[model samples]
Target: MRKIERSRMMPIALYRYNLALPLAPFQWNMSQNHDFIQSAQRTISLERDSVDALLPRIGADFTLACELLLNCKGRVVVVGMGKSGHIGRKIAATLASTGTPSFFVHPAEASHGDMGMITKDDLVLALSNSGSTAEIVTLLPLIKRLGITLVSMTGNPESPLAKAAAVNLDASVEHEACSLNLAPTSSTTVSLVLGDALAIALLEARGFTAEDFAFSHPGGALGRRLLLKVENVMHVGEELPQVSPGTSLSGALLEMTRKGLGMTIILGDDGRLAGVFTDGDLRRTLDKGLDVRQVTIDQVMTVHGKTVRPDMLAAEALKIMDDHKINVLVVVDGNDRPVGVLHVHDLTRAGVI
Candidate 1:
């Protein structure tokens, strides 16, 4: 081991030798481990199929679960332990971001005092690999008596937790991804898939729109989608780099460069939008050898420029800019006067892209 570790090429040579020599018991078991993953793939495909088959089979209990959640006046509380707890937290987040108010509560902590987070108007979704986890089972009676709706996710349908739930979604699979078929691998996958199904179904049933989703997820991609109004990130007032329509092309060029936006908005005498001047216009002007000092900006600026309303979405503005093949846009008010300027680079810096 020391000789191989110190040599530059010897390590690679030894590694190849070790791999070539491994045909005994250890290698035989190693090959089995690699092939066993095929079973894992089968498990995921089966779980996906189960989720697809589940929608139609929702039946009355499905309506009951939705009603239980829809009628909930308080938050939906999720509880679990171990691997199930991890999946529960994600489910809780999905529910919260998709219009349902929800959060995760650890069963151990619930027995201590966190149970206070759950109210009679709420529903409890508990996950347990065996429906008989002592920590989870102990809380069942208290949850049931509190008049909180109980839903359980478990691989064993007849387990206590499964029997306790007002509705039980069967997550049963043939075996696990564990070599000894003891680990929770396949079961965890099924649980996650089931939670996603529930969250999406409820999202659609409640008519939850992207605008609604943006309200809850105001910190990440979701928040970016909702919280960014055009005006919030636009260059307003003097930063707009604007010029009077009668200004000389030289004055427009000075305004564009001074503002550093590569463009200038041209306003009519009535403070209404008239046109736009940019470096592109400067190029066209130079093609005719027009002297910047003598030419009027009004004669060369592109008239009736494309504009966006101040109330439009930042994402929508990006689409318009992309479609027009322009990198900057003028924001206009109801009077059609330039109110602000938006640069594509500004949106990129703000993570609006």
Candidate 2:
């Protein structure tokens, strides 16, 4: 009887221990997930505060930095080390695309032989959060010797690099977003925002237009949209499907079939645009029991359909088509005479879509 009671009590104690063990691990997992979320939120909040801190700092020095870059006769050569180098490369590319000629040169490589890339006509833009990166500092004497203009973006305004620069744009941050307050987080964000501000200021000062930006990025979709004209992607000469307004619907269909444009332009005896017949029009005409052979195009054609100027941007022409739910447009001259036919496919082929 005594052994039976002891065995029963042992099982109850074992069960209780098993239940307690799971609770500990479950609780620990919940705490870990909470910590991860809290860490991320805290980091973002800190970085946001750091960027906000830069607003008051962007007064006289910011204007001076923009002025120097705007008046620069040659390219702006950017240099930095480590994470700052990565940000510098992006800033340089942005400046280059936005009307300012700029490029990045790694400080360590510049110390070796890449220094020759810099000339007296170029302005050197140095980036250093501490304002004392050895690799960048080592090149300052050489930059000065060449009589190159120096612009420094540094957290320490009184540091050697900043003191030597023609203008120092302060990029100081109170603390990093890292829990240990060591890794660069807030400082780099401030630097990138400041760099963008400088580039845009210069772009506005230079009166940079979309066409000028297109020229810089000719291989991109935006460039194609901005640079392509209706004339460049319109069906001209024999490719244009045209018929007299008095022509039979069957004859207009043949013209559309021959041109393969899914539409035909109806011109008057004086060669002025009178109407247009499309596949949609054919469907409507057939729905009305109109005879294709007996019906005149003028009876079923849409009069004075959407038209675009030959010199208008292909992108603008696309907007008209989208707005009007059209698949094609007639390219017209000053006299309202159809000179070319623009199909949606043409814009696609030209990469303007």
Best by TM-score: 2
Q: How many backbone clashes does every candidate have?
A: 0, 0
Candidate 1 Cα deviation (angstroms), residue 249: 1.6
Report how far residue 63 has shifted in candidate 1, in Å: 2.9
TM-score of each: 0.83, 0.88
Candidate 2 per-residue lDDT, tens place, 237-326, comes to: 988899997899999998899989899999998889999999999999999998999999999999979999999999999999999999
CA lDDT for candidate 1: 0.82
Expressed as tens digits, the lDDT of each residue in 233-288 for candidate 1 is: 89997787888867898888888889999999888888888999877778888999
With candidate 2 superimposed using the best TM-score fit, by how many Å does residue 190's alpha carbon deviate from the native? 0.9
The models' CA-based lDDT, in order, is 0.82, 0.91
User: Residue 325 of model 2: what lDDT?
Assistant: 95
**Model 2 score (lDDT):** 0.91
- Deviation of model 2 at 32, angstroms: 4.8
Clashing pairs in 1: none
How accurate locally is residue 62 in candidate 1, as Cα lDDT from 0 to 100? Answer: 55
